[model samples]
Target chain A: MTDADLSRFSINQETVKQWSLPELVEGCGKAGVARVGLWRAPVQEYGVERAARLVREAGLTVTSLCRGGFLTASEPGARAAALDDNRAAIDEAAALATPTLVLVSGGLPAGDRDLRGARERVADALAELAPYARERGVRLAIEPLHPMFASDRCVVSTLGQALDLAERFPVEEVGVVVDTYHVWWDDTAAARIARAGAAGPGGGRIAAFQLADWVTPLPAGVLLGRGQLGDGSVDLRRFRELVDAAGYDGPVEVEIFNEGLWARDGAEVLAEVVERYAAHAL
Target chain B: MTDADLSRFSINQETVKQWSLPELVEGCGKAGVARVGLWRAPVQEYGVERAARLVREAGLTVTSLCRGGFLTASEPGARAAALDDNRAAIDEAAALATPTLVLVSGGLPAGDRDLRGARERVADALAELAPYARERGVRLAIEPLHPMFASDRCVVSTLGQALDLAERFPVEEVGVVVDTYHVWWDDTAAARIARAGAAGPGGGRIAAFQLADWVTPLPAGVLLGRGQLGDGSVDLRRFRELVDAAGYDGPVEVEIFNEGLWARDGAEVLAEVVERYAAHAL
Candidate 1:
């Protein structure tokens, strides 16, 4: 990639949920972006196989697939369905030639206050699916969501806890995502990131590194307020240095979920993301 | 204190911010709540000295003072003002016969992103105030707010961080507050609380224990969404047991900030709070 192209930068489509698959591929291609992050629903809507081919034809790489692991359902049928969906996700990741399949460990089961138990369910699901993912040459990347989402979105709330669950399997099969937004508040984050990426029995390793800022007065639901890089309190350059020090030289995906960004022109958002990634995270 | 009085129960004034000092003292005393938590703003408005006298005459114990320590202000003058305010808080707590003065470490100063630096400023302020609090027979208790408030309310966002800062001073001089609403999502919380209260150099000792439940769909600005005892996902009984196991047989203050409850009759809110605390926490 050219110095200005930032070959390591990947724009997560959710940053501009306004863009369609073909539109995203075209936009990234014209902007000289080498990579784009994909989400399951939209990729499946465009037909995973066709979508994969479209990006491939455009010479754009899929840095990582959006999600897979909401496997905390208590009902036997629901749990099986979650696993089946995860398996399909693995297949899609393989098709897209993306190495990492991000897992947002689902929230506690309905009416369930057992956060520990729900977290264990994530481990169980990972154990059952690791081999499948390993065989497909894909790694299941456990994304420890911010604690705000601990109750209703993801039970995994810390990098260390995510590492504990991811380390139950071979490092090549399972790993952790080090998103600056979710983890900047964690005091132990820098050290834990080092340990996770270190070579040892407990090495879960950094599977993906996404960038987003932490802003205040989070909107209702607190889901769509992820700040664009350099817009909030996160020290993006420091995090970049940490991941790089941990030996992760993969794509640094920009995966924001902000209402303001989504409302802007998709090309404008992509351009701004590119510029910010270069100025703040690269 | 009667056998079934749950004598350790204290209600933070903010739970019913509507109640005047006289109203709260009368209400809490009649409801068999032997102790009550007070905020500086309302106390000052009601005349701090007079408010203290009212609670004392009502035979109510002041468990802890609401807050002090917004030491993250960037301007040098503002920082001095925060320290001065904290010193005044210590005097107020002493006057009210409260042993603990909770400190909500302020968020980042405007246009500032140096979180580590801001956190260090809290440590510095505590060092400056701990001795003053000790002389007044009041312990400076650092309250670790939830990570969601890291940018706007408190830079100290984890129980461990508070303990680390508090442990720097004499155990009796400095301590940490174990507020369930703020720390419930921390995986290391139970262990940290134990460490804080344990008898050793690292033993920061629990200065206060407050309760609130974790609820979702946080309101706009996310300030007043604190759940009442049984209305949210927190297993209050479990936290009550954790603190008890840590040998903290002190006031278990019920603090919540829900708009729904705040809009209701103060008496009805206190009644439900008592009922919920008895059933869900005590």
Candidate 2:
């Protein structure tokens, strides 16, 4: 495939979760994929500086970081630890030279029936972290997971809500991740995307645009059931066009979490993703 | 439980799906539960007229009918048949003396990415059915399934979206169902609940109030994973309070769909549900 074909395509680390950091860098280099989204655990495992050097030497840009937010913990000790870890994550993103650190705001605390209160805590946590992230040249991207994850994974469940939270800070410090699997069901998402992209001090909150299809019969726990690009009901092309119209000329990172895909060969999955991006996303 | 304690309680049929119509009637009678929500399939299996007579003789009021929607079909023939089926469902609700006929609007037609078109088709189907339903003294209740079911089961995924659709028709003709399981995750649900219960022609669209809990490690398919009241993270009492504050004093129906609950003896399950309702939802 031509480099131009994959100019905007980025393989999120979780999408090819079987690959080691070295293997990921080597594979992307060989496959002519110039961009990747890395996760914190593996980066830390391989030593963040070394891993960052490996990607740089391989001529692959770190498009974004997998995550840095579980900011819904209510306990003082746990909350403090969470913020410290997030600060570390922000540092890791800067070290990796990625512009964005995606955040999946944690869901309700155990026995906590106050969803509003949990969400408010997320806002409070962001208020603390945004300035820290900005100082390190990393944008904190608030991702609104599907509502099914609202109780256990992330309380932020819509683009509008993400923007509402992100708009509380400067666009440079905070932003939103528009993942098709998470926000595709909202009829108002297109309008919200336009709002996020509108020009102003508060606009351009589209920090990272990620792609994953919403397939059903979501596996038990519903965590790793994201479908491959063309295998599910999401209109990937429409989302791409929407982001394009909204002036987000950024990497379209593929971030499926399917066990089936993970079981396949990493290079094979990467190649298939490139082909899928061309056929479905463009 | 005393008569006053169980005053607003309604046992939805699916919660004790293993029970026969006769068993349900006898069981509710023995438990002093005055209200029951009926499902079309079981009512039809027992003969609609006979089931209606049985519940009536048992001194039970039918709070609402289980469902009467799949109204997003695109094929002309399928669309006509779906409308016909919904009409029969409305007639059955009327026969059973239930004012509300729940409509789970169908998702996109196969391989169709147009969610807006599919939802528009639901509005079209409702336009045709609302008058027929009003003539029979039935309010067509648009029930928004959680977004996880947006691809295959229902496109209506929020109270706001349901209200948007329901507002097009007269309040007596169209309304929305407030089920805690489906809507507990939405940050805007409480505000929308207040809107649904406001006074006037545009308001008071809450035709049904159902309760179920949100549990984690959702089972495959995610359909039968609804938790028993007090068994999961939902703020059942708060939802009840919200509805109460919004001027809705309707039947509080318990509608769980867990495999474990279904495996138990129907009477035992009903008694447990009653106990949990008292503890969690009152």
Cα interface RMSD of each candidate = 1.0, 0.8
Kindly report which residue pairs in candidate 1 clash with one another.
Answer: B196-B205
What local lDDT does model 1 show for residue B50?
93
The residue-by-residue lDDT of candidate 1 on A1-282, one tens digit each, is 235658688889899899998889888888888888899999999998999899999988899998999988988999999999999999999999999999999987767888888888888999899999999999999999888888889999999999999888888999999999999988899998998869443233799999999997899999988999988988899998988888777888999999999889999888888888888886
Task: Assess candidate 2 and give its lDDT.
Answer: 0.91
Tens-place lDDT digits, model 2, residues A90-205: 99999999999999999888988887888899999999999999999999999999999998989999998999899989888899999999999998899999999894442388
The best candidate in terms of DockQ: 2
lDDT of 1 at A254: 95
Error of 2 at A150 (Å): 0.8
- Sorted into a CAPRI-style docking class, model 2 comes out as high
**Residue range B1-282, candidate 1, lDDT tens digits:** 233566788889999988888888877877777788999999999988899889888888899998888888878899889888888889999998999899999999877888889999999888899888888999888999999999889999998999888878888988899998898888899999888868443233898899999998888789888998987778888988988888888889999998888889888898888888888887
Looking at model 2 chain B, which ten-residue stretch has the lowest summed lDDT?
B198-207
Model 2 B-chain TM? 0.98
